[model samples]
Target: MKPSIPPPPTQEDEALIKDYLLHRMLQTVLERDIQIFKTLELTMTNLYILNLQHIIKRMSDPYWTVKHQIRQRGIRIESKSWTPEGEIQVLYLCRGYQRSLLCSWPPMKEELKDRIISYLGTDLAAY
Candidate 1:
């Protein structure tokens, strides 16, 4: 039998991991079609856990919650759906009129784009 593989972090590594997680999460939110105003509250524990299996076993399935900055000043959306790509649960702030930003992600179908436009609001150039 082969020796066991070591996990990524030691007990002492939590702080650096936590800081990196915060910065990355915020950056990811900002770089997307969403613009979050400020981060009022953030709990970094398990913030970067990408695997849904472990989340389903130990915690709530599709586990993620943003109560501080994102909810107070921005948008908070929660949904569970398995698309052709993968099962996903997403929470994000949406740009009500960012057209180019909408195209930045994977190319959505025209129907999807029209639906998104309807949901987000009109294509006002003022934004």
Candidate 2:
């Protein structure tokens, strides 16, 4: 006797999967960005100056390569017929926000950045 193959997902199932994946992806991207920002705050400050553009430029290759790998994984998931659209749009949105957060001059609001830096300073000092 031959082994049975599972039935293809229904349209509803596909839509649910896509939505869930998009939500998870967005959450992951936000978490990663926060971590990156914290790391930069801890490492990139000199006196009172923070050259975020230079830091982002130096970090872009590895950052984008990881994102590309994530997209490739999504493609692989699509090939497996799990999610129909593969959440590519969600990835693009996440990428846009990442650029806005890291590549923009002065990056984010000074108060928010200062809060992050202060949190990091205290956190590291605890170690």
Candidate 3:
């Protein structure tokens, strides 16, 4: 008997897989950041801001086309409340949006920690 080949994935299947991978990647990034924050005494709000800045700086185009597109999709780029917890909440809300962009169009190869330091404009070696 000959072995049978599996059928190719449909568009729906592909979409589901893509969504799963995107969420998994976002979760992994968040977990790693939380662990680093624990050691560096960073708050959830700081993590949220760092991630937000990275997304804006890295994802936006000169014409603001990408930014506008994401905004149209109801992604929260700014925090509405003036509290750390609120910022953290916004961060969680932005996770799917960030991951969607990151998944469909990956940015340059840079670690989250390095990006955070760069965003802070601080020289770690000096510390």
Per-model CA lDDT versus the true structure: 0.32, 0.38, 0.42
Clashing pairs in 3: none
Prediction-by-prediction clash tally: 0, 0, 0
List the candidates' TM-scores in order: 0.21, 0.28, 0.31
**Reference-based TM-score, model 2:** 0.28
State, as a TM-score between 0 and 1, how close model 3 is to the true structure: 0.31
Off by over 4 Å in 3: 1-8, 42-127
lDDT of 1 at 87: 26
Ranking by TM-score: 3, 2, 1
For model 1, residues 13-107, the per-residue Cα lDDT tens digits are 32222222333333343334222322323363234232222323332221233233333333323332335554222333232211111111232
Which candidate, 1 or 2, would have the higher lDDT against the true structure?
A: 2
Name the regions of candidate 1 deviating beyond 4 angstroms. Answer: 1-65, 87-127
Cα lDDT tens digits, model 2, 24-110, are: 433454456655666565544442233333343444564565445545333223221223433133222221222111112132234
User: Model 2 lDDT vs. the true structure?
Assistant: 0.38
Q: What are the RMSD figures for all models against the true structure?
A: 20.1, 13.8, 14.7
The positional error of residue 54 in candidate 1, measured at the CA in angstroms, is 16
Model 3 scores a C-alpha lDDT of 0.42
